[model samples]
Target: MQRAKFAVTLFATVMAIGLTGCGEEKKPEAPKPEAAASTPPPAATVEIKIGTVGPLTGSIAHLGKDNENGVVLAIEQANAAKITIDGKPAHFTLISEDDQADPKVGTTVAQKLVDDKVAGVVGHLNSGVTIPASAIYHQAGIPMITGSATNPQLTEQGFDNIFRVVGRDDQQGPAIASYLAATEKPKVVAVIDDSTAYGEGLADQVAKTLKSEGVKVLAREKGTDKTTDWKAVLTKIKGEKPNAVFFGGMDATGGPLMKQARELGIKAVFAFGDGACTDKMHELAGEAAEGLLCSQAGIPPQAASKAFLEAYKAKFNTDPILYAPFTYDAANLLIQAMKEANSADPKKYLPFLQKIDYSGATGKIEFDAKGDRKDAEITIFVMKNGKVEPIAVVKSGKTIPFDEFMKSMGGA
Candidate 1:
């Protein structure tokens, strides 16, 4: 037997012996009493709670459910792998709360999570909701990673307790503009938003960029979340004869707009941000979604790490959405940092998380000091021939130059 040194910080040590030499004159070894009939004790189980907040039972229910499913899948994977935390086998349980895409509800849920003493948090699909919810989480010292919220200001507050696995709207919004300028080159564009924080922010960013890129803004309008029929809104845009239309809202609104806009004979290209990429969009828009284009942070689930996809499928029994894989990555990265720090306390894990080079479902995930995903990849998808296909993918290690990006978008 080849012998090697074994160092175990938490428990029992092991000694290996080499039988390379048999001593002919070995002194009579005292009977070792059969090594006290050694037996292994049961592995200790430690409980860690994970909290998630999303629109679990509202217009965005599908998105929330899918994100929760992914996080559940990660917990399953961790359990099967015998994940250890603080030298003890760790098992995670999810505490899910519904925000209904409401910021006030989101804040209440965040406070509830703080009371629950969860080890980490994984969601708040809406940027508007995440913004306020994160404030509560920060004050409580509970670290959270959001997979879907894309507002640039979410982490700009520099709260150490918050992190994002997805790219912010600033990176994705202008990237869509770049795509339009380089490929479609529509002469004029019409823009509309739901008037919510997330919807308006993304729309404003894209509009600023589009105008700078020489695409004329013929009309800009707002629609209510409660309004299902956007025919009037669609009619107004169609008369502008803009070559393209950009919408900033969730599938609940975007889906109906796509269906109505097509029926209204708006021949303009319909493009949206990550908020519109849910599977629900296909169901809502039907055939109208066929030619739509959108942008999102991270690659498609199929393009993510194989282990994550396999594990996700085994647990969720369905293909993941845009944010699911990002959530899984964020959760595992948090776990990795906790283990490496050898502490579940947020303070100890904070610094390690700051410097982590995490290999997650989305790809290599690292963070800047501000808790933004570093060197993120953004993918643009176009619904073609009845399916969404990735048309362009860009990965960069440096923060996108805001001024240059603005200039390229015709906004600087």
Candidate 2:
């Protein structure tokens, strides 16, 4: 039996036999130099910095982290796939900042991101923050994309550098108003806003539509961004005895407002815009959140891509909050633009971003001339038994009632 047991390739075996020559020691000739062979082409790699701004430290930190995680997960997947840009292996690094939902801090961080030379940005969840922060990005010629900020002025600023993955407040505000006027048949409603750009702007739209529909807006109240005790406003709202309360603000504040309203024995049906349409809102409002109404642009988070849901759960070990899917879409859309331009520079990719027509986690993602989604739909939900249950889908001037919507889902 042969002493060597390890198998060798045919060429290697032949070379070994020739070198040993039956175990005889033969005269060794001088070793010939190896022929010059072309070396395999080296892989090219480049580091691209991406900026993400949000209220990462204040009341909405959970939602901010969710948005940041969405971008992070997208970058992670792209890096894992070895995405190449401009003939170089592109490495994406996320640089996130906390605006604390303040317009001043938002502008400060926006300039910081500009100074850091980020190729693009995804952020400033509050429209109040995004509107002011966008100017900084525009001045530096960097692209800014937001997944959540819905205030129309954010895009109407005529800044070509600003883009969003979601629909505008113009669409969402009318949706809430229509629900109250046409569907719920409420004759009197009270409106409360956080007094920020997003909240007040949306409140104005709601109030206008309500008046047009002949629904009396019983009371219009204001709250600050940092407010936690809403008793003063709730007491004033209690006196109005409106059929419903329309809140224009983030969930961090909306949740407390809802809780206080319920505790004060004000049982008006609470309706809110997308700002408070989050999983966290349901939890924060507890049982009081039940039977509550909220409207979100497009489908529910449960309706996102299955693969995305699984991957998100695996990575974060928790369900996503509102806008995470949109954030993911924004990140990928920018990367797609970069691939089309063959460069990671925003100046090179901005034009491509303006014309993208791709299906994202949120649904068909195409931007109109104003940087708003061409025709994003809206889904209204009611909190029932600790879940935000989708009851209606409104689009194309049509409203699909809850039972019919479920029937459309194969009677789910």
Candidate with the greatest TM-score versus the true structure: 2
Residue lDDT tens for model 2, 1-412: 2434444466688989888895445312211110011112344566678888889999999989999988988887877777778777777777889999999999999998998899999997998899989999999999888998877788898988789887776787877788767777887899999999888888888899889989999768999877899999899878877888999999999999999889999988888887787767878878878788888776656666767777899999998887898888889888888988889988888999999888777667888887887777678888778877888877655677856654453321
What's the residue-level lDDT of 1 in candidate 2?
Answer: 25
Residue pairs in steric clash, candidate 1? 212-410, 212-411, 213-409, 213-410
lDDT of 1 by residue, 1-412 (tens): 1233233422232222222223322211211221122212344656677788789988889999888887877776665676677777666666788988899899988888898788889988988899989988888888899988877889999898889988777777777766776678899888899988788888888898888878787657999765689998888777778888888888898999999988987788889988886656788889889878888876666666666666777766777865788888777877888888887778788788888987767767888888998867677888876667777765562223333332332320
Return the TM-score for candidate 2, rounded to 2 decimals: 0.68
Against the true structure, candidate 1 has what lDDT? 0.77
Model 2 spans > 4 angstroms off: 1-43, 180-292, 297-299, 385-388, 400-412
Among residues 3 or more apart in sequence or in different chains, the pairs in candidate 2 whose N, CA or C atoms overlap within 3 Å are none
Per-candidate local distance difference test: 0.77, 0.82
Superposed model 1: Cα runs more than 4 Å off: 1-47, 55-59, 83-105, 185-204, 207-270, 274-290, 297-299, 385-390, 397-412
